[model samples]
Target: MAKNLTTLALASLLTLPLIGCMTTNNVQPIATKPFVIDSETYQSAGKSQRIKFIVLHYTVSDNERSIQLLTKGKVSAHYLIMDNDDDKIYNLVPEGERAWHAGDGGFAGRTILNDTSIGIEIVNKGIQPQYKDALKDSELDYHPYKHFVEFDEVQIKKVAQLVQDIAMRYDISPKNIIGHSDLAPSRKIDPGAKFPWQRLHEEYGIAAWYDEADKQFFMKETQLATPTIPEVKQAFRDYGYQINSTAEWDKASRDVIYAFQLHFRPLKPTGQMDIETYAILKALNKKYAGRDDFY
Candidate 1:
């Protein structure tokens, strides 16, 4: 009995400090008073997600320089995919925080894209001068648009996976999965012609693309009468490009068309409204925007 009493007393003494340190509820001890957060019971139903788009880009430099510029420089992106054999992905900025990647651009009537989109920068040496020189005199004129270097196959797969994950989480529209060039056609042309948008659409089931049958149908109509410039501009606008109905094929219009062709018809992005280009545009607007009539 004496030995049992001694053990009980020792245990009581050992627990005294802990008991004294406990909160009023006696659940646990806290070093200092803490602000209580009540998250278990109530949540508001009026909230919606802020992320609406994903904008892709190419860094146009080596990996080291790409990281340096994105991290230290004025411009930044949420993610960066290096073009190395390992195909590493770096989260440069958090998705919740707005990166300065989308500057002076809008998409599908949404302006200030930086607030509503996540940007991904892939390290690539864009548009080698030798390639440009070779294409300059070729009959396959892509005048304002040039062939950008192809992304590493491994790098592209990682990009597709990242995009898939984000899009699934945010429920972002396939049409809103776009390139830097798509957002600001006049000022930017990145994730350029060689970005393999078709591959992403076909293989990964990512991004919006026109139906081949729809395109073929529109192609036949192209032989009737050429679509007017204003009509073409309106088609572009309806298809989510920030093009104006300026009534003529101006430099700005050409730039926007170049951006479009860079994504869709990369082989000959001449910035000219040919039969093929018109048909492609109409097909896209019809499929994506729910427009039945050709412009």
Candidate 2:
């Protein structure tokens, strides 16, 4: 009996750990005490919304490579839209979790955008694949690789729907919907000039658009004198571009201008300040000022 009791005690002791492990592995919540529920009627004002911006990017490779890189590699996106004929969008990472896209960038006075933005990576080869063949015998030292691949109509439609759904859910402002190049102008340029900003704005209302009337008015009034460098820089800043507001047309300013032009004026992103670019910046600033609801 004594030996049996000792054996029973050892078995119980060993089984206790298994029971603990089983309880720990279970998904349900475990309460240590009987709890009484208390209801609080008042809501606290200390909380704020988690999501604020939506940044768009284009994977510089095919869909398979994009998936491998985004999944196994260091970088990740909340969503990935495959460049197929069908309407399919893959959710690689959950919306509630942060993705490693939009590294070292800011917009609208917000930096480190991964914490506050939902990143969507579209699977599209950014530049022309035939760039080498096209520029084989050119005397030009620099090859202006064509970065204007047309996104498939079906893919774009799916992207528009997904963006609209996310915007509605998070209350993300139209102005806050931006491209990867828009934020990290210095180091990155994906979702380049080819991505249709105007269509998304005009048709889907997912992004802010430059008012045509405002553009026409600016063009009519400023026919003779182009906007000064300082003026143009200020306008870019007012429109939430991360650029220096200086009179000198420096490299930083040029990079930001290039990014802005890629988004607003894709046909001519010369990286040089021109009347048209300045006017567009002014219109964007005027229309979107004090309207971005991020709190």
Candidate 3:
């Protein structure tokens, strides 16, 4: 009887793991609707009106979720660039009709943006933990938007190429192509610092770039040091950036900083001015002023 009891105990223990692996009636896959439209008149901006901006953003969700949420889920974009390992892009919203991306956005002294710009939401998290030295995506399981995101290199290359393609087609000046935070500073922060703006500039030249020398601090000592508020403000203005220049800093200022960091100094984006940022600003300002033949 003792041997029989022991055998039963072992069998019960083995059954626990088998039961764990058993298909539960509760965990079945939910059916996803095939979200599609005729895709008619998607990019039909007329000859009279102009395409002024190419706003960049991160989906903050997995590509699949992004598609579901944006198109089928009411929120949408003129273009949804899902550049994961597969390097795919979907045009969920038509460019001419103003996609629902850039929710409550503004830019260049204007309070409205969707009417003048094309929105592209890339699939990315675009945030880091409070004080961590680096982004640990593997540690992410609880974020509201990161439940399905798995970003990689292919996504980036596709972003640059797609940005270049759209900008060229619409005759949007490189300076006009900006991130979503650039448009609505106080309200949004997607396509955060980890994004490779420099790579886009170097490989595709879609956005602005500074002298590689300006990327490091010591390498650029005499570079645009002590730039006056007027100078900084003017530089931002020339690039068509909006600035409040308030007595007390507000959310709008931080938004522009987020935008600037996404474009230039993406690694440590506190929106605080540093040597590299100053040089890049000065260089960009000078470029717009026709100081450089390239500009």
**Which one is best on TM-score?**
2
Candidate 2 lDDT for residue 265: 87
- In order of appearance, the predictions have TM-scores of 0.80, 0.82, 0.66
Q: The CA-based lDDT of model 1 is what?
A: 0.84
Residue 152 in candidate 2 has what lDDT?
80
- In candidate 3, what are the lDDT values of residues 176-236, reduced to their tens digit? 6777777776666566656666777877787766765434543355354566665666667
TM-score between model 2 and native: 0.82
What are the runs in model 1 whose C-alpha is more than 4 Å off? 1-45, 131-146, 290-295
- Model 2 whole-model lDDT (C-alpha atoms): 0.82
- Error at 126, model 2, angstroms: 0.2
- lDDT, candidates in the order shown: 0.84, 0.82, 0.65
lDDT of 2 by residue, 1-295 (tens): 9999999999888867555567655667557775866668667888767888899999989988999999999999999999788756889999999999999978888988999999999988777877635536764322232545778888789889999999889888888899998999877766887888889888888788899889877876667677677777777777788888667978777888888888898877777777788778777877888877456
Please give the distance, in angstroms, between residue 101's alpha carbon in candidate 2 and its true position after superposition: 0.2
Clashing pairs in 1: none
